[model samples]
Target: MATALATKPQVSAAEWEARQQLAACYRIFDMLGWSEMIYNHITVKVPDQEGAFLINPFGLHFSEINASNLVKIDIDGNTLDGSPHPVNRAGFVQHALFHRHLPDAHCIMHSHTTAGMAVSSVEGGLQPTNFYACNFAGQIAYHDFEGVTVRDEEGARLLANLGDKRVMLLRNHGILVMGQTLPEAFIKHWALQRACEIQVATASMGTPLLVPDAVVAVHQRDVHMAQVPGGPGSADFAAMVRLVDRIDTSWRE
Candidate 1:
């Protein structure tokens, strides 16, 4: 009789790298107080020819996520792999819209941080309060409140709100940031959330102060590149990943 063949499970080098970065992104969000009690999500596109992606298993707190704990799903929000926890279909709806439509959006991050939501609810959302906030000037998009984003029907509106911009404020909801690379996506998220905090604190002072002029804001945003040791692709996002690891290496395990 002919010997039977066994197909070995495959995990490419690219997939392993994506898994590490995706896991690191989760840890960073957890450390930053951006998590919403196991409600928010950060998803990354799978590597190679696969159009699927991975996200934190539902019901698990962000701090509890590990490289192996993420569940894979397709653009339609169907679970491609079996896991103990259910996937967040509501969260994935928005994520899938971006991954399917935005070619540059390799990683997508959504959060319900207090500051972020506060800004979103304000009459003026995400004001260009400082240099960090200027990058969003004339670029940020906002989606009107349409109840919870759980159905496939919500995808079109979400995509429309996102348009071509990589950053958005979900009106009366939360914040969303996407990037061509995982590191850039994570950094943009951090920047947006921090800017929201600053804006809220400044507004609380109840003082009318001068805001930077559009020219000044744009200049500052551009000049920030000089302060970084390396711009864009050369920045030390890997350092951020390592910092997360040092703080809690268990995420890797």
Candidate 2:
């Protein structure tokens, strides 16, 4: 086990920065209650390193993730530099498919939140019943659940279902989203979580009202233009980063 590989001097500056940012993201997911123990994964591509990515140490809880402890690996899931911790190849089975095929998929996040899973199980996925739901409108994609995503062959099917959409609801599973950068991916998931939460909350309160298609069109346009306008350095992501910093800066190690 090479825990010494976690140090800044052990890797390039770009990789180190990516590690710290990704570790902070893990902490953010834990704080937001999106982590399903160590089940789902949030992976980021190593900057300037073709085909290289970073994923969490398989056995560690999201709350325990730190920059130094993350494992570096390739699209095939082989460790670039031996890690003290083993990497979960199951995560790579799905995530690698996107990072390899989509240029904009720099960071990919998957969450199994209770609300998300509930919404996924229904015939209709994420409805236009709330403001957050309206943001996605008719653009959310859906993929049929084929048990656990541990097979490499399933990667092609998942990508085919994803198409050009940024967000997808895996039927009977959860939510999956990818972005050109880490912050974009995070903000998108934030909206998805809220949409799912509201949908689940309304399910028990009688028939839910749906937004008109015309209004949803306008709403999507406005929300897109207003959200993360500053792109990668968006205040939406920066604000969350600040909060995590206050709660525990250990992820930055």
Candidate 3:
């Protein structure tokens, strides 16, 4: 942990703040039960540096992540800070494609939650059965599972499938949420996870689901309108940060 703190002097104030926000995001994911051991990743770009980003050290649990321990790297998967901990190669390969291709995607979160994977395996992806699901209507992308997304060539295919979309369902794998800000990505992941949970539970009952198209359209428009700068999600994210701080403040280290 001391070694992690040592790198703080090497970065700018903006990048340092980005690290803290990203670290808080990791702790928040742990608290929400979204982390998949040390396998999945949540990354945020360094402000004003194209192709440079911060990701969790590969072996540490999400709850163990902190602003100091986050690893800095470029789009080519090279660690810039020379940290003892290694970055997840697969995570870098997958997330870098989005960071390089989409300029607005400042934060990217990938997860393998039970409900997320369950919904990914189904025929229709993210059925608009509920309000949370409706907000993603016509806004989700799909990419067929190609093993573990390690190869360099697979990155292009993944980006092609995810063209201009904020959320994607990695078929037979998991879900990826992109955001212009950390809070937005976290909120999208929360909503998508809830939608998947609802789908799984409702499907288990063997009852036909009903999603009115007209109503879904209206709700989708309203959701878009509500997602302005410094909207409700920002407040919710601040509240979650306070909650995490109350629980363990160590993540802020």
Candidate 4:
């Protein structure tokens, strides 16, 4: 936490806004009990600045992340903001891979929550047994686990497995969700987590009821909930931001 804070005067309004949102996201995860000690990551592209992005410092816990302390780095993972914190090497292996190839993947988040990891390690990946899972139905992708994702070699396979889907369950590992914006990614993450949590809860209740593919299709195409003016999760993310702010305002630092 001794690292220098990127002050308002030091960065563009766009970049600073990105930093504050990313920091608030970290706090939101902490509030939702999504954080795992000091691990996992949530990153966002620097606004109007392609290739460069913001990430939490490697050593800080999610509760400790704040606007000024996030690290700025390129697609290759080299630190560009002169911050003293070291970017987690493993963070770049998969995150940077998507950032490089997926032009619209501006916000990427990865997590290792109990339900997420439990469903991932199960015989089959997420099933459409519940409402949230129905949202993804046949769209979730799976990647066979190859130990911790520290090698560059894993990026190519990850990219191939993900293709165009924004949500994936890393088999025997956890969840990864990408979005064109921070709120979009967060909403996807919320739905994925809920789907997995419900599936895990109902698995012991004998035969699990499944939503029909036809119904799932209808759910996916429902125009009533079309992208809000703020983006995919904009409205929900806004409410969440207000909640976290009520809990603690230090993330705005």
Candidate 5:
């Protein structure tokens, strides 16, 4: 309810690992320039908990975050981390709702990247202007911006928008990507952002562009399916985990 700074607490080894990965996700988001101040958040479910999620603490910039600084919270947005450092309430509204209702969602990443936002503002939203967009054709969802999601009443709409999809474009706002693992979420967000970037750039070119057919789009998704770490229907989450180490090994500490 209130934003305050608090000390990082000692967590069990397993919990610590989860914290580390989640924190690394924050760093990766920052590195990709997907962050919107300390506002946007990346959340992952605590491995063993139902209706409980882990997210970055408020006030700390993504670059300054380490594993120990991550906070745990319940579906109702209550901090379970035992720290006074507040969790972003809006983060709770979107993330907690996903974890609470979608059993397949273990990791959720939201961003305000410029290209993503630009596409969201477009009349048709994200179009299949390129190969990247084909991978998400008929697979993306959209949520209308309802101002800030600091209130609980917005949870239903958020859930409705996300439904059973793994990717969402927040109309007039930004983008959201959810998956069964951190890597899945990260990759989806990356692909979504890239798709948006391509769409915006192509529009700027003012040149007529050829679009891929649905059959090609389906094949593209299948090609990507093999890249998903945990197998079919799963994002290549393991690869993403490895990527964090490549980006910043300190996130593991």
Candidate 6:
């Protein structure tokens, strides 16, 4: 558990709002059973702060995170605001690479969920066996894991592997999803995990899965075209926010 800070640094209204949304993301992760203890990370770029972002404090469980407790830091992992909690070194290195290199990747989420890790270790990454998997038919990337991501040089390899893709399966490590918004990122992560879960369950039956290439292509096109303002992803995310609000609104603090 992390010790709560006695005070929060003064920040801009936009920064504060981003903090609240990011904190809610943490709680949502906990509610969906996507958190791996205090490991992994979800980071959002501060609205107007160049190269600055917000991440969860190192020791807090996802459920225990709140707006004020999140640590604000630059791309280099230097603390921007005076917070007592230290940032996760590995998390910062991995996340900062994307944030610095990709402009559209405003929100990034990394997970170590059972299904996600299982699929990552498989021979072929993210097979298009179902609708969920098909959504990532040609939009996913893969990176081989080189143990814990502590070395700074690993960032370049990560970027190269993740070229022009929204999702990446870290072989033998985990999964990552990057998006223009927090809701989009969360929705993509949810879809990827579901795809992995379905793949594992079906593979255990030892029956040759039959999803036609044509069908997968059509599904991928449909998913991309349906990505509108009030579409499935955004709508479901809004509903989730309402559910999280009803359960415990402390993350807003």
Return the top candidate by lDDT. 4
Q: Residue-wise lDDT of candidate 2 within 75-160, one digit each (tens)?
A: 99998867768877778888998999999899999989999999999988888999999978877889999998888889888888
Q: List lDDT for all candidates, in order.
A: 0.77, 0.87, 0.87, 0.89, 0.77, 0.88
lDDT of 3 by residue, 1-253 (tens): 3233434437788998898899998999899988887889999999967779999998888888888889999999898888778888889999998898898889999999999999999898888887788878889999999898889999788888888888999999998999988888988998899999988988888874668889888887677676646753687788899999999987767
Q: Is candidate 1 or candidate 4 better by TM-score?
A: 4
Task: Give one digit per residue, the lDDT tens place, for model 4 in 17-135.
Answer: 99999999999999999999879999988987878988888878999899998999998999888888888888877898888899889999999999999999989789888888888
TM-score of each: 0.89, 0.94, 0.94, 0.95, 0.87, 0.95
Q: What is the lDDT of residue 146 in candidate 2?
A: 98
Tens-place lDDT per residue, model 6, 83-199, is 889899989999998999899999999999999999999898888887788888888899998989989988888888888888999999888999898888989999999999999
Model 3: residue 59 alpha-carbon error in angstroms: 0.5
Q: What stretches of model 4 exceed 4 Å from their correct place?
A: 1-9, 223-229
The predictions' CA RMSDs to the true structure, in order, are: 5.8, 2.0, 2.1, 1.8, 3.2, 1.6
Model 5 lDDT per residue over 1-253, tens place: 4342345567767677778778777877777677777788888888866677788888878877777667788888788877667787878887887788888888888888899889998788877778778788788888888898787788788787776778888899898888877766777787788888888888888974657576666667577545635654234445555676776676665
Question: What are the runs in model 2 whose C-alpha is more than 4 Å off?
Answer: 1-9
lDDT of 1 by residue, 125-208 (tens): 987766657767767899988888887887787787777789999989888988888877877887788888888898888863
Worst 10 residues of 5 by lDDT: 228-237
How large an RMSD does model 6 have? 1.6
lDDT value, candidate 6, whole model: 0.88
| Model 3 CA deviation exceeding 4 Å by range | 1-9, 224-229
Q: Which sections of candidate 6 miss by over 4 Å? A: 5-8, 224-228
Better of 1 and 6 by TM-score: 6
